[model samples]
Target: IRDFPTLMTKARICDEDGKAKSSYYKAMNDKKGKGLDRGKPYENKGNGN
Candidate 1:
């Protein structure tokens, strides 16, 4: 969300329902929150590898 603040805005511009798909949205959910951060960048614990 913070990383791509204009994502939602761009999606809504063409589609009022905000259901339209674009490259930005494709790349966003593509990760499936694998590296998403709720607080700090290291909040999600892992081997960091």
Candidate 2:
């Protein structure tokens, strides 16, 4: 599950403003295979030079 629930299960007690919780869910869905995240970062798609 990409270590999501591992954190969300504690979000209720960790995040007071719920900002971290929201971002976590967004990241889980937006992130693709190979651990590639293209949402907040638009530069990680390097050609591996």
Candidate 3:
């Protein structure tokens, strides 16, 4: 949940029309565990730093 803002910001960098930003919020607020607030710890899929 806390990362949503940063995610939206990064998304906006790729999509300047704000489409990704809007969708991101929608997904985060979505019901069930399908949203960003799925109550799971974030996993870093990137290379371990």
In terms of TM-score, which candidate is strongest? 2
lDDT of 3 by residue, 13-44 (tens): 77865777888788787754766655546565
lDDT of each: 0.67, 0.68, 0.71
Worst 10 residues of 2 by lDDT: 32-41
Candidate 1 global CA lDDT score: 0.67
Ordered list by lDDT, greatest first: 3, 2, 1
Top-lDDT structure, candidate number: 3
Task: Give candidate 3 misplaced runs (Cα > 4 Å).
Answer: 1-17, 31-49
Q: Write the per-residue lDDT of candidate 2 for residues 10-43, one digit (tens) a residue.
A: 7756666588779888898876454544354545
User: Where does candidate 1 have its weakest 10-residue lDDT segment?
Assistant: 16-25
Lowest-lDDT window of 10 residues in candidate 3? 36-45
lDDT score, candidate 3, position 26: 85
